[model samples]
Target chain A: MSNSTSNTPEKDHKSSYRAEERRTLSSGEEEFFFDVKTSDMEVNMGPQHPATHGVMRVLIRCDGELVTGSQVHLGYLHRCAEKIGENVEWLQYLPYTDRYDYLAAMNNNLGYSMAVEALMPGLEIPRRAVLLRTINVELNRIASHLVAYGTYGLDIGAITPFLYAFREREWIQALFEKICGARLTYSYIRIGGVFNDAPPGWLKEVGHFCDVFEEKWKEYRDLLALNHIFIKRTAHVGVIPKDMAIDFGLTGPMLRGSGVDFDLRRDMPYMAYGEAYEAGAFKVPVGSGEKGELGDSWDRFYVRVEEMMESIKLVRWCLGVIEDGPIIGEIPKVIKVPAGEAYVGIENPRGELGHYVHSDGGKVAVRCRVRGPSFTNIAVVEELMPGTLLADSVAIIGSTDIVIGETDR
Target chain B: MELQAIHDTLKAAGVVGLLGCDEPRPANKKEKDPGRAGMPFLLVDPAEIVPLLTACRDESRLQFDLLIDLTASDPAADGDDLWVLIQLLSLKYRHRLAIKAHLPKSALSIASATAVYRAANWHERECSEMFGITFEGHPDPRKILLPDDWKGFPLRKDYEFPTEYHGISCE
Candidate 1:
């Protein structure tokens, strides 16, 4: 790596001309021309680049083709959601949750709703609303994981699967559009209940989707999971051990991939989760290989695939047993709760989306903080990246399934 | 474990003397015991947090391996004490202990839990940056979410949002 070899004549001419100009200016003084050495190479992966998936700037320090080190610069998309949450009313803030993790808006909605609902004891949300919420949220989870698995393949060399994943995702989005007015940011969930009841034949459409998803899921696995190139790209890369995963406070599939058998829905059931119908239907099955090694990119990928299958099963179950009833719970027009603090954690698509809310016996919450799983997942990148190659870093990041919106929120 | 037994154990350990254990809130909410029998809550000084956590971790009955969540709240409207809440969960006992340390907002200094739990590194960093609380022993204490040159702690009640920093106007 020689700095003196000027590759382009234009750059060399400009450099020499600047040097000559400086020399002419310092003719009357004794000046020392200290040499300034640049690095071996530097690349800006972007605040605008496509592979970054969001407005993230990663400055990569490379020696030849290998990455020496890297620094992640976030906040390009920061909206100060916590501050915004404080300014808005409890119900008004429900719409903003959708923007936090736009990929899985329903999970975000459910997390905030559950936290608020926890404060108000004896608020009975109808069975239909709970079932509707479960179905839509599972659909959103499938859509989110599809984007994760598909874009992950796109992050690597495989481009065809990205379209395939998007095609399936569009179907789910269509169902969401039918239920809610919006597609991506469906703020369908209310504080006590949902915005509205499910439309006519909505359950049938979801049931039809569940019927078709099993076959489509196999196609997804065949396109990427069985592909030798993708396996070579991801396997044994970005392995976060069980202890390290726990120490880093990693959750969701990332923690489960490291063999931690903790799922919030299964471990600590909340909001009609442990009911007899939901117990048999909506359980998330953990993925396992022959040797039972959990901490690998393959395990993470397979877990998301298995989770999608489980989510489909859950949606089918919810549609069959759902009964028509009042969506909103009985409460005063102006909602007020006793002064107390409650922390609620829901299993979002990426990980545990925890909300810690403190109320001062008023309509407004005193303090609310979201414990985003993406934040913890992204923190372990420094631990995972040291020994891996430059290209593999993208795979590791994608496999980690980080949404910078959620992380930087 | 019964609440009285838990209180008795803490009293036996000599932790009750430092913080006055006079009036305990009864486990039964209806019982009006103004000056109760035992300490319902233990108030450990900010400096003694690490040692107390270590003791709790090492104790046979209280093997608190998980530092569940750490948060800072402004309890007083007059901007008095910054209440730091630390929730520790023991996997062995399946019990949770909530420890709160009240410090003046001006001097928001507390010992870091990095040595006890590695997960506390980021949690403490977030708390420190957001609430203007300084975790004394944290290795990398620089701003986590906010920019290095950020003017004020945004989460604090008294924080004023700046229009600009480093000649970049936020407006």
Candidate 2:
């Protein structure tokens, strides 16, 4: 990587033109040899701006069309869910996790439940239940990625992709409703296992949805994933440096987008995902930058698109092995977690959603902290967002696919 | 390569009296009373955190580069002693280790892990505000999930929740 002011010029492409200070131009308008300007426009970009992705305000200072610097204002949606976790019993707090990443509700439930289960000694989840959880979460991943794909398209001014993404999301939601009777905030994944077993046709319906999804996901790829406008808007924009990505604790697509071949499900191996990965049912899709430079906004967006396909393969594998058995574990109805502390990190659509449960020898947890991935993922923008086009801010945030619901929580 | 073996190496390297300086044991297996316990962690002195963390990251054998998570718990016992959880994972070695620092609430501060792990900035800020534990020497120690005007640390075990704020009732 050469030292250049020209868009940090890609590592391989070094330009000889030095961005030096000094010089004058024709006409009355002066042009400095370097691009330094005295004046900067400070714009408040949102707590409500659709592009900021839900109640996140970025105070962006720009020199003409280029953003000079920015400061992010968060906590517009802080409900103190962790404080509430201290008051509620282990099982009672399931709904709270749903709110953290409402887009990937089942994944949230899975992470929290697994954390609590780790506190209990010799607690075993039924084989059928684990399969059911793997399937449910992968489906949720597909659903969440669809929203990412759609909103990313929307951010780049492609409205058709949003509608198409939601078209698939609605179908996934319908399947979830058949299982747990809730579309957005389903508190179905209980601590021991799930709230209930799959309804009679739910498995078959999900299996059928997988078949439809394989073709539809590629249809989505054709719609906006490969569209020229989307590529131009995203490729090479908001390129996250590898060191910054790891230092900021970025996970999920954001880390993978930077060409880091790590996913907790595959590397850490939890639930049935370990078995699935070992059986070659799924592969971790790292960002190779087929459309643009690695770690760029395009790679971030492309990672999510590729992950949905990997999820489809995992779901299909899970559907094939899902057996008939009890869904819930042998947890006490009162749900008293013995005095202990356990932390479990699960791979979510956004990244690693870690749940820290500290029990105080009672029914309720002493302190329950949620390590929301979006919370960490959003921090990188403070460093990467500057020195980019003002319009590309929307592109960067969309590619990051942040749900401020979790970021602010 | 494993966390237990690394601890043995640390002990051999003269890093003792951790978890409890003189008394280190799991919370459930304290021997005063016995029950099933979760993972056991070592307690380090506040001053030793940065150096230990540096060694943990730079040491070729125990290269715990990723600080997976950092949190503090307000146990709310007699002495106002607070517990901080530092979870570490070595991406290259594939092992996990945790260190618990018992910071006396009278001071409520310790060396910031930011010097070792840049990711601790936000986590430290959140810890500072929520549990009232300050990560001393943190570059940006602003409140993360709480407002600037917020009064008390909400996650503190004994902290009271305000029934109202300004002109609005919280209920």
Worst 10 residues of 2 chain B by lDDT: B20-29
Q: Identify the leading candidate in terms of DockQ.
A: 2
User: DockQ for each candidate?
Assistant: 0.20, 0.58
The positional error of residue B120 in candidate 2, measured at the CA in angstroms, is: 0.9
- Structural similarity to truth (TM-score) of each candidate: 0.83, 0.92
True contacts kept of each: 0.14, 0.55
Model 1 C-alpha RMSD vs. true structure (Å) is 10.5
In candidate 2, stretches whose alpha carbon ends up further than 4 angstroms from where it belongs are A1-38, B12-17, B20-32, B77-79
Q: What is the DockQ of candidate 2?
A: 0.58
- lDDT (tens digit, per residue) of candidate 2 on A266-336: 88898898889889998888888676677988788888888999999999999988888898889888987
Give a tens-digit lDDT track for model 1, residues A167-263. 9899999988888878899989887888788788888888888889889999998889767667666656666777777667677898788776767
Name the lDDT value of residue A21 in candidate 2. 27
Clashing residue pairs in candidate 2 are B17-B21, B19-B43
